[model samples]
Target: MRRLTLLVLLATAAPAHALDLTATVLANKTAYIPPQCYTRTEDAQGAVHNPCQTCHTLPRSPNFVSDPDLQQDYAIPGPALENPWTNLFVDRRAAVAATDAEEIRDWVRADNYLGADGRPVLAARLDRLPPEWDANGDGAWAGYRPDASFAFDDAGFDHGPDGRMTGWRAFAYVPLPGTFWPTNGSADDVLIRLPEAYRQTSDGSENLAVYKANLAITEALINRADVVIEPMDEGRLGVDLDRDGSLGTATRVVFAFAPLEGVTMHWAGRAGTLGPKVAPLAAGLYPLGTEFLHSVRYLDPRPEGVTMAPRMKELRYMKKTSWQSYAELEEGALAEKKEDADFPDRPKQFFGSAEAGIPNGMGWRLQGFIEDAAGDLRPQSFEETVFCMGCHGSIGTTDDSTFAFPRKISGPGAFRDGWYHWTQKGLAGTPDLVRADGQGDYAHYLRTNHAGDEFRSNTEVISAWLAQGDLTPEKAVALQADIAPLITPSPERAIALDAAYRMIVREQSFVKGRDATIAPQDETVWRRVEQDAPTGIAEPADPWFYRLKR
Candidate 1:
């Protein structure tokens, strides 16, 4: 159920602590204006609609944010990391009022918001939908999104054949009980807030209401901010300063979405095409067929099921491709090539080249791995309980109950297993790792909690239970406090819904990529942005580079 509550919270190992997370990492540059749009295109008729909010709040599907011949790759705040105490809300602004700090700055960089006396400001709209949140009523609009009708069904994931839509993906993570990211893959204390199109009821998904949005670390601290934590291992969790102004030391931030390896949701189809001969993209860029519906904006496709129709040509995107503005992720790194399907790193593990079809959503931000290295964790880098294996361990299937893959790694590596460790590019297998049934204890073995059923590598039963050592720090603190609240993430999942929330915390029918995700590469780049992403009362800088350990 819900991914076995996300593998029992991915077998708890997060000991490190020191989280103020500066109002959830300055609510990650919040400001996302996508008030609505779901079109079936039969002239438009399925449900949900906003047609475009007078001055732009949400009505450009595919997540629209265009007009960037290139403003730092599409800027709105995406590549981020120029630093100003984490650039404090980037260009900040967009607060007419709709709380939880404007849904964490509209999930950051959608445009930056928070003006009205709160401080760091910039956004300007105000027509209807804000008469003061009907309270307990039904009129709804306290500001989360999805009012106009609400239709979410991309119809059997279209494809006209093998071109698009096989759809169905979910993976949510804003679970804040003590929220904090960055074990060491390095998106560094990541923060992103999307929520605004969901009112749907005609059988779509998120009609609304998830609940929980705190943000008050003394508002973010300029004075009363004291913190300390760093334990690492049990899986992972860490921190020691960076609450904004301890100034450099363990400095860390990480996140890496893996639908399976690298990224690349390709399709370039129509519009004077550059490489649409069918596939093989990368060169000069250009290939988003029909400008990709509403125009190439990076991430805006929510059909989940049923609506499918528009499959040939429509081209009308003077803007909105990959729909720019999470401040464009800080400033670069999303040419969208599905990141190239990554998993084989043991030394290059036997080479690449195997792409083909179906993909276009689910970049779970590579689930988890971030290390600031001041002490223990950070061996090569991979902390934070592997962040739920980015999608229950990148599917490709494993945890083998019987169906195997070690005859020497075939097919998707025989449907994957041993949670991936391999090692033989130039012949590296001996103790080089390739485990699957060594015994068990990989901090508590996973694979959606072994649901794919037949798993084996318990590292020789945790090395014969640490060599019959009768381990007990109160039995490892009561077996990690009974699996830490069962799988943390409740506060109503830190409230903030726009449409899809993803609950599969655990499911392992050999997920070795059966339902894949982790996509990103589509192709489109220009980038130039300099400043302007803050919005929520900016003004706070000190981090010479992460601190709080001494």
Candidate 2:
């Protein structure tokens, strides 16, 4: 009997199977390699090679490197004098002739041009290619080389049957600037938003590219996360859910880590920012160990009726499912006893989902983890292992129900006038927090911040196309005037307008032969094509802007 007791103690004393990792250590070892294309040349005649990393890198150049449509045909010179080459060779004078450059661009774009040794040249563009493509010449451009896999979802995600958000679609929820939780434990705390039961509007006005740019910029400012779940202090950071000038009874906030998606916008003609840029990893995306943390809060007994204030309406509480990478949970997790003394920090609870097979847990890596605001790893209860639905799974946010859209410009130094106008006057329990918009100079925030450059550039180019269906020097000037007043009073509103206008221009840019060489008679069509591409080649929407605001 004594011998049997000794064996039980030995088994119990042994630490949970191999999960003894600190938050920092775990973050360092499990580096996420973003998907990109690459080129490798062995011989003078070898074919150019492109893996995922290689494909995503070419577009990052200041000049156009590859065409999304794979257009190799030379473009006819027009009065505007656009570069017709599909490759990065933008200086037409360097080519033997314009047509020569165009032909070379085509060969490189198609990934079919043979080098001296006869290997395939790497394809340069991914935004234009479908999720899957045929690199092996099987006559099928199946979804991205192996399976149209996305960097976030390549590890396999689960959204359950009812939730269809995954793959590239799930990227819409990636966090934005100003939302990164600062570690100072001071006033720069990131706000926690509750999930709205019903959506109030259908205005899909948030420009995704602009949103993405802000996120990239913010990633440069603050990269660490305080992952601890803090109890919401009604007097400190709570919002009046019903705009009734009162805080909710209880609010629990959570912050977790995720991989940063594509950071900068890499359009053919757009200029990059003068501000600092995040260096790309070998995979051409954010490097491994680079982390993006998501913040969510839960409010009990959601309020009803919206009165210009954010509202949460529901009697019952809602929580998100767990998300996991393609990597499976470590063995022996399931059999581990939940009642074990150390169960809170156990790997099973950290990786398991409260709601099994739900969409939130699968693609977004919304697994439950225990950590403080400083990212100090801790143990969490199985009950607390719910996934985050406040942003990714919410039903009312403008950017596909994610806070990425609204917070795009809501971050520090974003608003010149401050956010006072958006809320009611003298809300009870509100603190005297200093913010960019506090001075009532929204324009101050709009003109000074780096995002202003992106917004103005998008507005100047996209607004012209929306107003005239084509771009002209005169049309461009006129549209800029119309958008100027709206920019300062409300930067977020202006950004939403910019997003909406760009959507229209993007729809018209993808018509067939939009990039092909053409005769003078086709000049109008070509000009339309040029104007059409106020954004990049990829259609953010299927029927361009359909259900955009929903």
Best by TM-score: 2
User: What is candidate 2's TM-score against the reference?
Assistant: 0.20
Q: Give the distance in Å from residue 78's predicted Cα in candidate 1 to where it truly belongs.
A: 26
lDDT of 2 by residue, 398-461 (tens): 2212233223222323221112222221112221122222321212222222122211222332
**Per-residue lDDT for 369 in model 1?**
10
Q: What is the lDDT, from 0 to 100, of the residue 545 in candidate 1?
A: 14
Cα error, residue 143 of model 1, in Å, equals 7.5
> How many angstroms is residue 381 displaced in model 2 relative to the true structure, after the best TM-score fit?
48
For each candidate, give its TM-score against the true structure.
0.17, 0.20
Residue 328 displacement (Å), model 2: 30
lDDT of 2: 0.22
Tens digits of per-residue lDDT for model 1, 1-550: 4454344334322332332211112221221111011111011122111111111121111222222111111122332222111111111111111224233223322312223333212112211322222222344322222111111122111121223221211111111110011010000111111221111122333322110000111111111122121211211111112333232342221111222466222211121122333322221122111011110011111223111111100111010123222233212223221232242111111110000111112211121111111111111111222212321221211111000111122112221211111110111111111223332121122211221101111122223323342333343333322322222112222221111111111111111111111111011111222333221212221111112343
For model 1, where is the 10-residue window of minimal lDDT? 178-187
